[model samples]
Target: MNEFLAAGLVTALVAGFLGGGHCIGMCGGIVSALTFALPPSRRHPARIASLMLMYNLGRISSYTLAGTLVGGLGQLLVSNLQEVARILSWLAVIMLILMACYLGRWWQGLIRVEALGQHLWRYLEPLGRRLMPVTHPGQALLIGLIWGWLPCGLVYSMLILALSSGSALQGALLLLVFGLGTLPTLLLTGALARQVTSFFRQPLWRQASALLLLAFAFWQAMPLLGFARELPF
Candidate 1:
């Protein structure tokens, strides 16, 4: 991969990791519910691990699919209107900054942004419910595919970054890495929800993560503004 694509993927991963606190609050309940839905006999430690793995695979696949579509749109803009691509990149930087603010609790505006997806989610949620009390990993996978569409500000913020990606492949890769980054927190939550939540909830950690993301946003913005500098990969 080229330097720009490499950096984009790295930034996407960091954003997902740093946004763990938010993800916990947004999806923790659903994860817990899914875990409990497994039949008792299938709730063994190894079995639970398998189920969680399938669910996340399904969720991340959805993210990759979304990224592909948005990235294709971005590719079209870049092909036809280079200036528009630049403008969208700047907008993506702004969205990243806003994401940092939301992560740090400095502002809640992104919550309003999440409203954009609610209408679609309303339709998908019942289908997800139908797959509940999942007996097989396949069923869990299907449910997770649906659950990935649940509206969240963090996900939307990342989508903006995906859109800024110049090609469909890069956009899909960016989100794929992002989904992998989120896997740790979400996968572990079933076994260590309290501890993981407490760690991410600490003010020091949250602020530090927010600052890191903000710095990344600035780095991305600088290149767009003709202030490019070598970034350690």
Candidate 2:
């Protein structure tokens, strides 16, 4: 596998698990609203599950759109091998550091970077609000697409990983996978937020996940450091 691809996949899974803590803070109410939007006649377990799945589908679609855009951008930088890989490797290192910060409780400042996406999100906001009083699964799904534009540091980090992919399809898939990874927590916000949040807060788990991410970052950068290079499968 490409080192960049590996890093991106790892990022998606980690972000999915850890990134959700922030979702509960920012989007918990959205999840609740989505649930309530379901028809009371079929408010049983299956209907709720369907709504959750649709929300995730919409969210993942947004990630895919983002990945395609960034991945295409990456190709523009591909002509200079050393330069492009150097930047990408550095990006991986930065991602590791940010992950460490989130885990170590030392630097909460990373969240502020999400503001960079707020400009685009501002445009999407009105559309999302229009979908309010979500009465059908399709409306809920559309709302998720708009909601996917929500400013989030974790999503941005994953976007960086996608940009590092060096190919449009790969980059898009990377983001899609990352978005899918977060599905469990985001989908369950109404039911499992408390439990998942508590468990994720464990110091040991956070630290371990951080270290794992740091190691992956180092590995991804190894090619630029002369430690490795792309090899045939």
Candidate 3:
């Protein structure tokens, strides 16, 4: 049970760190836009923090719904709970590696392969834009949920991880934690807007974050690589 909790927490942090990179790259604009949306009178840190939390709550709620649906389907595929759990464990390892590569920029090499998804995103892009002129916290929250499904390898990788949970509830909870982990970084970006975005874009930070993610990936996967049998868990 401890191991499972550890995996969930590690997965959440890694998901946030890795996904945060892409968030900086792509969704950074959203953060910036959100900052401007607020009236100056309501721009106090406390108020901003409350709005950020609400936004995250909405985003994480979407993740939970998605995970529950997928995990439910996964449960139906197996008669043995043990087998499902084993599958989830291995899938988490795989996601860890993929997210590591993604953060490292190594996964960019596969862009040619992923180009097909672009066509789908092209259609979805305009739909998201239609939600523009967001006037309320609820609007921003709902928009984030719609945008959550936006095609990106990072999100797809996490979705794969979510699917591995074997049970709907577990999958939902895992994704919620993952979303929560991402919340702070994103909230800061929203608050600071362009400055934070620029800071994250610094080559040094990117490289450092990438390396950190890679190290965590290995840490998460090492135990599963038959090393525990030779050493101690």
Candidate 4:
């Protein structure tokens, strides 16, 4: 990938990592439901891991699909490469700032943005509900497929970033990488799940993650600010 694409991918990755808190808040109940829904006999580590893996893969696939659609739209609407680059650059920084606000719970204005998605989510949610008590990995996977459309500001932010990519393939890759970045946090299960989720949920941790993202937002804006995108050190 070119540096532009590389940077966007990296940004997506970091955003996903930082979104661990949001993920838990958004999907923790569903995850817990899936866990408890399992038969006691199937609660072994190996089984849980497989189920979570399948579910996440399904979720990531949905994200990739959204990226492809949005990126294609961007391509059709924008006919200039330089224009795409500018859009990508500006959007990366803007999304980062918004993300920082989200991570810290400083501003919930993003919740308003979720309204745009609620219409689609209502249609998808029932399908997911039907898959409840995920008795099998397949059920978990199916539920994930449907739940991926859950109205989430973080996911939507990443979609906006994907919109700036202006290439369907790159947009898909961006979301794919983002999904991977979230894997570490979302994969948490058993005792580790509580410990890690608790850590990410703490005010200190959230604030720290938000601050880091803010620094990153400024770093992304360096070029636009008339400074070298890469400091010579």
lDDT of each: 0.86, 0.73, 0.65, 0.80
Per-residue lDDT over 12-131 for candidate 2, one digit per residue giving the tens place of the 0 to 100 score: 776666656565656777888776766788677767677677777887898899888988887677755647856875785687678667655667877778788888989998998888
- TM-score of decoy 3: 0.79
Give the C-alpha miss distance for residue 161 in model 2, angstroms: 1.4
List clashing residue pairs in candidate 3: none
The clash numbers for all candidates, in the given order, read 0, 0, 0, 0
Best by lDDT, which number? Answer: 1
Tens-digit per-residue lDDT, 1-233, candidate 4: 57556777777898889888998888777777766777888788778777787788788889889989987776765665556657765876787788899889898788888788989988999888887778788988888888778898888878877787778887888888888888888888422768877888799989988998788778777767888665322
Q: Give TM-scores for every candidate, taking all chains together and pairing residue i with residue i.
A: 0.95, 0.85, 0.79, 0.91
Worst lDDT run of 10 residues, candidate 2, spans: 224-233
**Tens digit of per-residue lDDT, candidate 3, span 138-203:** 767776776665556655555566666556776677677777777767888877776777777776
The count of residue-pair clashes in candidate 2 stands at 0
lDDT of 1 by residue, 145-164 (tens): 98888898877877888888
Q: What's the candidate order when arranged by decreasing lDDT?
A: 1, 4, 2, 3
- Pairs that clash in candidate 1: none
Off by over 4 Å in 2: 38-42, 80-82, 201-205, 228-233
